[model samples]
Target chain A: MSQKQEPRRKPGRPKAGTDQPDARDAILDQAEFCFAAAGFAGASLRDIATRAGVNQALLRYYFGSKQDLFDAVFRRRGGMISGRRHVLLDRALAEAEPTVETLVRAYLRPQWEMKQSGPGGAAFIALQARVHAEPEAHALDLRREVYDPSLKRYIDALSGLLPAIPRDLVATRMAFLVGAYLFMLNDLGRLADLSEGQIREIPPDDMLEQLVRFLSAGLLAPAI
Target chain B: MSQKQEPRRKPGRPKAGTDQPDARDAILDQAEFCFAAAGFAGASLRDIATRAGVNQALLRYYFGSKQDLFDAVFRRRGGMISGRRHVLLDRALAEAEPTVETLVRAYLRPQWEMKQSGPGGAAFIALQARVHAEPEAHALDLRREVYDPSLKRYIDALSGLLPAIPRDLVATRMAFLVGAYLFMLNDLGRLADLSEGQIREIPPDDMLEQLVRFLSAGLLAPAI
Candidate 1:
């Protein structure tokens, strides 16, 4: 219940300065793995502590319970996530008349260049996938806190291209894009085999252009 | 473990007809709901049986165990699912050339028009959403058995139109479309309040035309 935010905390070690992923980092790592596997209720502090090579006493010393550890994990990473979504859209939209390709690339590039391709990409993707399916309050808090600011820019850019479509329909189409983005980011392993690695080589610009065209057409299609 | 498929029984109901949803049907419904809410191990047969207004014995009688019941639910719905996807796509593609709009409609129409629409569509959606997130043997079985056939058709059609881009890229775009379809069908219950009723009101032909034009432009767009 009593959780503290360590937002301004230094990136490296604590006061004593220990090495490794860090006790805090290690705990989050195992929690991500556990939550991804056993889910929220099914995972235990002992399991996490065991996985992290730490004692249960140290876990409680830092974060009161399993959920406190979870809260810390969400709060710390949530900004990076929203930031990824925000930067992509904002950078693309900054153009005088950002083409659909620029816009699509803007949306996807941040994820790929950062989390999706980096060391922790798979775990982050798994966490995102887990949140979508389960929707913990911690994750929802971050989603509500950050989604609009990050995504509204994309909606505006898309609206600019399709003036004929009603504002609400534009919003609906945006919603469609968001859903698809979640699938692409989360289904890495399945998609790895599914698409045969074209996602890897194709330039983000071209991929994005095709995405916008496909989505714009599909969303505008009549509901049969 | 002796889970028989009711091999000797006649189709529909017995001549001495039963009024209930049937033991097997009840178990499936309850299992789907419970699985949707809590997932596999998180859900219990006693809970499912209680939810179905039947005894636990009935569930065991029809499906042997929880795993058996889970497999049976997916197994029963498997054909209807894959068949609907193929039929929808086939109808949409039968024309000399197909537009993205028609393709989108055909892709989505089957899930919308099922006879079982009155029940918990959201629950089923949520369940599938959860299963797809983690993906074990159960999720894989359904994906291959229920999804791959139609997915191939969609990919083949898209590949024909955009031959320059890699075939895998086309499939990823298709995956994006599927993501949107799944989200709309499952969530997005607030569409009416959002003034998104236009999605439901437009004629199917007009809708398809708009979608195809929008998709075609972007898919073929060399602007990137």
Candidate 2:
């Protein structure tokens, strides 16, 4: 790692600044962990600072406040769905006439891959789970404040491919499917004996098959 | 209603034994509500007792500790599903055979309408959501203490119905379905706006139809 650049510290006798890990990263890391474990309202700035091993007061100086810190964390390193999906879009579009299984896999695999191998990745995944529990906490706000538009783009893209299902039904089902993705990503590997890499091998194809079976049969209008 | 043969706590002085609302039920009700809102580790017995209008000391007298209280709420609504129908055996048994719609509604509605519509129903529903969030909190202990053997009977019943799907696949699909049910319930109306009497108009058949149409097609096992 390149030598860390010193973040500007407020003027002080001790040249006051983070005495431990880089204050900004440390705060973000701690906030993510706490949000993942205890949820947003269930945790506080004091709790994050203590875990980050810094003066609680410095947390405010570094991140402005807890909500701002949360926003920064939400915006951290490719966390939001804001940029550069041309490759994913091209692939999904290429399969515009894809089977249900193929389509489901296309939608879910990106989120699953994002969950791999990072410090904040797992914690952010957990924070996402926490947001699901207390949705009023941040799910919509983060969506709006960040990249909901990109998400809509993806959803609209999927809908184009799934013309048979009613749009509203598709929207609701998509919401639930996304919930499943976030839930499984947050805890499935840890809760089960499987490793992250291990669960990855389940073949998105097989999962896609199951999702197709579910949606086609699940929401078909009452013409049993 | 027959008056107690023995004079109960007089109205003015009020008997300590079992008054208007006995301490135990009050505690359970309040604890379930608190646990639903605050989660297992997050809620305090004092808050539960306060909400119940019982003294906090009585909480200790009844349940010992907060974890004990947590366990109590999950176990409180025991016998929600007593056992599976042994005769439900002879049906055409394939995950495909039940038709996606039948399976989807069957998998979901139990969690939806499977409980008593009493004061604790909403709170009980919330309890399930918490369990989904932190399955570890209830897993080993609840498995030992609360998992009804009848659940296997029901899964077996499903297995018998969905013979084409592998056993493990059925189980995983069921797991995701359970996750979907709880997440949607947390977000969607606890009960659909239709009144209980009006709900009869939307029979199990129609509900199942909606589920199968949507989920079956969306989540089908990908065709090779």
Number of the top-ranking candidate, with TM-score as the measure: 1
* Per-residue C-alpha lDDT of model 1 across residues A18-81, encoded as one tens digit per residue: 4554787788878776776666666788998889977677788888877777666655666676
Candidate 1: deviation at residue A41, Å? 4.0
TM-scores of the candidates in the order shown? 0.75, 0.72
Best by DockQ: 1
Q: Write the per-residue lDDT of candidate 2 for residues A76-130, one digit (tens) a residue.
A: 7334434534356667668636554455555555555556647567667666665
lDDT of 1: 0.63
Model 2 residue A112 distance off true place after TM-score fit, in angstroms: 0.7
Which lDDT tens digits does candidate 2 get at residues B14-95?
5667545676888898888887776766688778878887678778887887777777778766445222222222232433
After best superposition, candidate 2 residue A33: deviation in angstroms? Answer: 1.6
| Residue B153, candidate 2: C-alpha displacement in angstroms | 3.6
